[model samples]
Target: MKKMLLIFSFIIFVFNLLTAQEKEKAQPTPANKVLSKYTKEFAVSLLKGVDDSMYPKIFKAKMSMETIRKGRNPIKFVYEVYSKGSTKSLMEIVFPARDKGKKILLLDNNLWMYVPDVSRPIRLSRNQSFMGSTFSNEDVSDSTWEDDYDPEITDEKGDKILLTLKAKRRDVAYKQIDMWVNKETKVPIEGVYYGLSDKPIKKIYFFNVKEIAGLLRPLDMRMADLLEEGAYTDVKLLELKELESVPDYKFDITQLGR
Candidate 1:
């Protein structure tokens, strides 16, 4: 009878141990929690280019883009951008008399470009170049990495963390990205974008850190196409302000005609 009791007790102890192991497995690991926190911070920093807060907000800014190429006069454009969150945005060119009043709208996965004289807005691919610059249409618009990419901490360097991002879906612009983020600030310092073949196609550097709208962020970005020599795009932020509300019509496709 004592042996039988002992055996029963051993079974109970084993069951409890298994139950505890399962519970631990169900909970998020410390590493996963840390990754989540860092990813959120990084997403906030990325969206900070337009708005400082992660909440739903509107922003207006002046974008100055300069493109340099061999044997050609450098091209420059100035645009006024209105953005809502990281999914909707409208950009209107304000400089260079001929291109004035032209607009581009980004609503979720849809992109449209409206020329002043065109009868209707023309659909555009997100992968298309923005006015023949190194910057793609998707680059100028607002987007969040957390929504499109799965991030993992692959390595740790002194004062920096190396993050590898794989696209969660095939429609994303880049198949994968390797980013070096500042450990202290949780801001991306540099990123290398890769195509489906895992070839590096473009590189981006985030610099000119400053406080804008009461938040610290990188105000300048430089993007270079690895396949092209002596060609790159530089985007500078002239102004950024929070808006109380943006009219719903502002994001409508019909509004592009207006």
Candidate 2:
């Protein structure tokens, strides 16, 4: 009887494991929003270019983020980031001793935080502030915008493409975004984020463009809180190394804190 029970438990564990892996492979929800300008082929091509330029398929990097407020001293955090494809990423705090050993993971479109003392990881909301920074949790994770938004070409300025993205589903962190993309590079330049009410809530500016992995990529970005003046978080990618591949088990949520 004990052997049968043990086998049953093993089966359950395998089922749960497969379920989670399948969830990570889920496709993007289709957009119901109106797209006035983008053609099917062109839109797909543009979004692909943007995603590719955003980050490499597999990489490990060191980064720093500084949050500056109106009157308070700037708060800084350093992290070692690892990403696999567009779906899995893990970041570990390596600086500001107090936050050391804390980790953040993104998997299957969900965000989680793992602390040294916490028995289990805690699920986090996508729209919530990330460690009290101006950047939202979604801003830190959710790198695959193409999976969550439908694109429309609204306008163009010299050397820039004004692309507007409408959320494909209601659960996304932002309802709409008007982005400025480099015409030649297809990399994002600047963007304004909006909420469900269509009110502009935040803005992001990407800078420090340099060649990485044979493509020009932004190594630094500033996220501005439109609701509060003089509040912004600057994220800098201090080091990056492209990898041919990363071990899949490294992104497993169950192995996160271990």
Candidate 3:
């Protein structure tokens, strides 16, 4: 009877050891490896669905801006953004031609302040901030993903993959960006922007993930300013339409005056 008890104890010990080994083997190490490959795929999916027809074409945006310091109703504005490539961009705010009107034109690397009372376009620097918001003309005028950045995978985990992106042109607003892509969904979960100082300038959090045009994408983004303790920016995508056959001439800087 004592010998049988000893045998039973040994069998239990061996079973526990086998269980622990299996658990260790099941750790998500392989999932991390698969995530790295999906990171590149996510980047391609985002770029491919961005409606190329919008490129070299004009699109209308109904936007509102409110001064944070003053408690006032948000100022409403109607504007058109046109883009062709990295070198060219044009923005024209329409005057009371219809519903909302305040006409201003931004062309090429310069801004043209258009006041109906003034006769000609006033040249302004691209460095000027837009409506006291974090975005500048350089940020607004940036073309698609291809023109702005070149991304490479830096690190990966079970459900997270890190990407490091470098600005392709000197005129780009940010120098580098570190993006985190979700493994299962293949979408960007977060992005960190670095400035010329090689320090983190902003961190963008993506939420409300959804599948659009057969691709998973973020519907809302919140940006935290790393320089300022409590300052942040929120951008909500109201709509995303895949357009076709946007004309090239519409995006030209020369079209701004017309």
Model 3 lDDT per residue over 75-145, tens place: 33334544444454455554235423233443444556554445665665554555454555554554454
Regions of candidate 2 where Cα sits further than 4 Å from its true position: 1-38
Q: List, residue by residue over 10-36, the lDDT tens digit for candidate 2.
A: 999999999999875552332334346
What ranges in model 3 sit over 4 Å off? Answer: 1-128
Question: Which candidate number maximizes TM-score?
Answer: 2
Candidate order by decreasing lDDT: 2, 1, 3
Q: Which pairs in model 3 have colliding backbones?
A: none
Cα RMSD, model 1: 13.1
* Deviating ranges (above 4 Å) for candidate 1: 1-56
> How much is the lDDT of residue 60 in candidate 2?
90
Is candidate 1 or 3 superior in TM-score? 1
Kindly give the stretch of ten consecutive residues in candidate 1 with the minimal lDDT sum: 47-56
- What local lDDT does model 2 show for residue 146? 87
